[model samples]
Structure formats: structure tokens, C-alpha cells
Target: MRYGTRALLSKALLSLLLMAACGAQAHFQELIPSTDILTAETGNTLALSLKFTHPMEQGPVMSMAAPRRFGVMGPRGQEDLIDRLRPGGTDGKRTFQATYRAELPGDYIFFVEPAPYWEPAEGVMIVHYTKVIVDAFGAEQGWDQEIGLPVEIIPLVRPYGLWTGNLFRGIVKQDGKPVPFAAVEVEWRNDGSVTPPSDPYITQVVKTDANGVFSYAMPRSGWWGFAALLEGDTPLKSPDGDSVPVEAGALMWVQVRDMR
Candidate 1:
């Protein structure tokens, strides 16, 4: 009998341990814009609304901050940023929502982590992240143009973390028609730092294609300011042999000149 009792007690303790483990795996659900594709003007403020299957416990501390600890990597390998979702005051009917906004034009990713009290037993916590592309022209015009230029900077595969490239493409309208350029000159700066390559692990330069489209690439990653030169006094030679300025948001020049 003594042996049997001991065995039973051991089983009970094991079951309790398993139950506790299950309880610790709470997760999030019902995230709005689950795949949030925010196409907002540069200066416009937007909110990211999130809902969950389970209500978050009141008074639990939450946090929202950019993820920077992870090292810079290509688009596929980059880590997502974590933003804490705070209860935006309860609705009369008990529904809850949280919101966030993009203040600049570029790519941004966001994720969420719930506090311990909000977790559920045997459930997996969900972390959601998405890339948002903000249009710079929207900032000045307050509206997105149908034929506006879009720029993207991509990194090339290189060793020693130093090889990168950039690509620029836009529609230039002349006589009410589309004139596509294969290349253009691009100039960019980091957040108040005049250091070479700005963010250390990146590269920014003017690039052109046989069709007059422009592009640039960086070896590193960080917040960067950039502009395109349609036509200007060329200070430096470009890889495609075009004279252009390294400026930010200069695509308008090309449109204006073509219109003349």
C-alpha cells in the first residue's frame, strides 16, 4: 500500500507540472490588418488596430519599441520590430483595439508580445510583423499620384559585409505620355551623421541602366534619407556614365522638364 501511494503521488505531481507548462503558453489572435499593407502619405499618421481572441488582463504592462539588437541582413533574413499594444480604452461593449502609425517614407516591420497574465494554457503566442512602404510624394501632395516614381534600395550578396547596389525607376511624362528612364542619380544621408556609408554596413550611390532608370545599393542597414537627380550639374561620375545629383525627392525635376 505504501508503495502504491507513493506512485500515485508522483503521478499527481507530474500532471500538475504539465498543466503549469501548458498555462504558460498564451497567444494573441484577431489581429486587424493581419497583413497590414499601409500605403500612407509621408506626413500622414495612421493607426494599426489589433484585436485578440482573449481579452488582455487589465493593468498588465506592455511595451512598444523598434527592434535594433538584431544585426542588419537582407530583406528575407531581417528581424521584425516589436511594438507593445496598449488598450486604447475599453469600448462600451467590451471590444478592444490598439493602434500605431508610420511617420516616414520607407520600409517598417512591427510585432507584438503579450504579457504573462494574458497568456493561455497550451496555446502558442503569435508574433506578427509586416513591412510598410510610405510614399514620399504623398507627403507634399497629400494624395498619391497615379504616375509617381518609386525608389527601392537593395543589397547585393557580398563577403566582408561590404557589397551593395541600388536600382531607380520612374515614369517621365512628355506630351502627356509616359517616358520611362532606365537610370537616374541618387543621393542620401543618414540621421545627422556625415560618416561614409552612413550606417557603416551600407552603401549609397548613383546608378543607371541602359534605359535611363537609376538604382543604388547599400552594404549595411539603418535609417537613411535619399533623393533622386533627374538633371543637374554632375559632381561625380555614375556607373552608367550619366551626370546627376545625389539628392532626395528630385524626381519632380524630370517631370517638369519633360512637360516644358
Candidate 2:
């Protein structure tokens, strides 16, 4: 009886550890544009979608509230786009969409600052500062422009028009200063074609150097998301009115094309 009880206790502890590891796996705030590189022939406008999810898992999407802030930084400068956001969804989960007319020949960086989300499993409030770049009319200038987000990834490589297998690098910044030795998570948007052989394959992790820069090479052609996570200095109130830590994430999305 003693041995049996010990075995049962061990199993319970292992199960709890597995559950925690799965919960810790990476939740991404996705802000993806309809197209990364927009040609003149494509159209005069762009459609952007926003969601919070585990991208590599293809999701059980976490419902997103209306963003706290939304805007675009382009050749002319930043413009408020909060009013343009429309309600959208998939699989019964609430999401957001925005349509913007591209009147300039330059790179447009679309950004979203989501409202704080309480994750019961993690016992923290999550706020992801998400952005994506769309190059318009063959004008590649301004892809690196900073939107002055609280936490952001300023791309060392142009965020759009990339081929698979190319190295992508970005600097993780908080309040315009590099966040040394930051942790960044990378995941590919699963299109239902690939499956992870193990749990670790779902979200790839990398750490920034002392200068707050990290790099990864894209192995497959698809939309890739990079999230640099930092703990906020201030705690927020949970749904239960308890004070909880805030997980502030800097997220960026970029699309890669196949050689074919």
C-alpha cells in the first residue's frame, strides 16, 4: 500500500508539471496583414486581422477584446486607426479586422496595443504590442520605422518580401531602450499541413544578446511570428480583483515566400 501510494503521488506531480509546461508554451498576439508586399495591381487597400492565440498550434483562439490602441505608421507618419477596427471572428471566437487604403508608395507598419487580458492558468494579465509591415507600390523604405510602442521589435531585416531560409533579426526594445538578454519566442502559423513531433517543437525559443538582438532562420514558407516577452513593472487587477503581474509582449509578424 505504501509503494502504491508513492507511485500515485509521483504520477500526480508529473501531471501537474506537464500541465504547467503546456500552459507556459507561448501565447502570441497576432496582427497579420492580408499581404506583406502589396503591388500596385493588388489593390488600393489592405486588410489587417488581429487575434490572440497559440499560432503554431493553429489555435483554440483566445477571444480578444477591442484593442486599447490601433494605428499605422507610414511615409506620412502615424495615423489613428482605432475607429476603423471591425468585429470579426473564427470558430466562434471574437477577433478584429481593419481595412486601410494605401495611398502612398512606402512601407506601412500597422500596430495594435491590446487591452490587458487575464489568463487564469498563468495568473497574469497579458498585453501584447503587436505590429506587421506591408510594403506598398514597390517602395521598401520605412520598414524599420519605430511606432514608439511600450515594447516593440524593431526589425534589423526588412519585415516583408522575404524568401524562406533567410535569416531574420530584430532588436527587442522597451521604452526605446534595448532589453538586454530578453527572451523571444518564434512560431510558424500552422496551415494544417505540418504537425509537431513533440511539445518542444510547437514554439521555438531564443534569447537576445546583451544588445537585445535575436536572429532566426525561417525553415518553411509561411507567416512567422516573433514575440519578445517582458514582465511589466506594474501589476494589474485580475477579474477576481486580485493584483496580478502583467506579461507585456512585443510581437511582430512577417511572411516568407517559397523559392518556387
Candidate 3:
């Protein structure tokens, strides 16, 4: 093998790796509900959509397998909704969807534990525990209930019915305990009206304080996703038959409304 040929090959490989890393920067597990706060006028049944993607970019959606677990935790208790998920998609991309009737007036916290995704570019498996809270008929009780996920964001403020400028706050928890100084990445779901000026503007980031709590006031009205990332304690087998670290994320989606 000629030295010049080897050098060219190495440069090409480096370019490809850099591109992959940039693509993985804003990966988010989205568990978005039709309406964050449900009312009689809004509708009786709530619809939820689950997907993995770069929310702000809103394209190049990564394929998602059937979730490992899906359910809701409410005033009554946790209910297993794994069987309720149905295949859904848009523009030929795979996604999951579910519908539930708001039987009682209370807060319904919907969550999904997605199957591990193998990312060869990053050389790690990604699994995100994602959730969203829906308040039914103004019964705000149980919005703060912890569902005992492997990783999660327990909201400090009411998760639903917020004005655009309200401060959204939460505590990053893993194994039901606070993760002090955890890092959180925030992104707005772009609806084609706004274009990011640069890669950094696509995803905003913040760090938890000593108490494992963080806050961000959304300036716009729409769905905002917060992902608190943690390195998994255990490694998973990769496609290449090697052990690789896992990137476990605690993700929660909240919606803000514009004042009339």
C-alpha cells in the first residue's frame, strides 16, 4: 500500500466520522401527546406519538423499533400500555402512536422506554426514557409522580398549562434519586417557520445545580423537549460483537401556549 493512498483514505474516514458525530448531537426520544392539557372542549381521547429524531431539524428521523415499555402513571396508579401502541408513520418513516380516553379528571403522565438503538457512528447504544404529562379537566394532581424509570425528569413545576414565558423546571433523577449537576439539552420542535442559524442554535444546553434541578423559560409557544443525559452503568453488545457504552437519556416534553 502506498503512503499517499493511505493518507487519503484516513482523511476520508475522518470526515465521515465527524459528520456522524454532528448528526448525533440533537438526537431526542420524543413522547409527544396531542394536547398537553386536555379539557372537555379539547377532546375525550388523548393521542400520543413516539419517535426518535432531531426535533429542531425535524428531518432525517432515525428508525425506532417497538418500545420496550409504554404506559401511563396517574392518580390511580401505573398502567401497562405496551399492547396499546400501534404502528404509525409519516412520509414512510416508522413511528408509534397510541390513544387513551381521559376517564377521570387528573394528571396522566405518559412514558415510553424505547429499545436500544445501535449507533455505529458514536460506537454506543442509545436508549431514552421519555415522557409527557397531560392534565385532564384541570385536575393537576399527580403531575409530579415519579414512575420509577431508569432515568427520568421529574417536573418541579406543573408540567402542563403554561404560558410561553413561564419557567419550566425539573429534577434529573436516575434510579429514583437525584443526579446532581446533570447536563440537560433543550430543543424546540421546529415547524418549518424557523431555521437554525448554526448547529449550536439547534440545541440549547444547561446543567443542573447541586440539587439536580434545572430551569428554562421558553420564549416561544410550542413543544419544547428537555433531555438529561446519563452514561449507563452497563454496556450492551454492539453489532460488531464488541461491548459498547450506552447513552441513557431522561427526556420530557412540555408545551407552552401563547396568550390570547
Q: Which candidate number would show the highest lDDT if scored against the true structure?
A: 2
Error of 1 at 136 (Å): 15
Please identify which of the two predictions, 1 or 2, would achieve the higher TM-score against the true structure. 2
In model 2, state the lDDT of residue 87: 89
Instruction: Name model 1 segments beyond 4 Å from true.
Output: 1-44, 47-132, 135-145, 148-183, 192-194, 197-204, 231-260
Q: Which one wins on TM-score?
A: 2
Alpha-carbon shift of residue 94 in model 2 (angstroms): 0.8
Count clashing residue pairs in model 3.
Answer: 0
Please provide, for model 1 over 1-260, each residue's C-alpha lDDT reduced to its tens digit, 9 standing for 90 to 100. Answer: 69999767754553453334323311122223222223432233445443322212221223322222211112233333233334443342222344444545433332232221212231212221211222222232212232221222221211111223322233333222332442222222223444433322232334344433443443233322222322111123344454322211122110000111
TM-score of each: 0.24, 0.91, 0.90
TM-score ranking from best candidate downward: 2, 3, 1
Question: Where does the lowest 10-residue lDDT sum fall in candidate 1?
Answer: 251-260
For candidate 3, report its TM-score: 0.90
Error of 1 at 217 (Å): 1.8
Put down candidate 2 lDDT per residue, 42-155, tens digits, no spaces. Answer: 986888889888899888798988899999999889999999999898889999998999998999999999999888877778899999999999989999988898899999
Local lDDT at 138 for model 3: 84
- RMSD, one per candidate, in order: 25.2, 7.4, 6.8
Off by over 4 Å in 2: 1-23
Better of 2 and 3 by TM-score: 2
Candidate 3 global lDDT = 0.86
**Count of backbone collisions in candidate 2:** 0
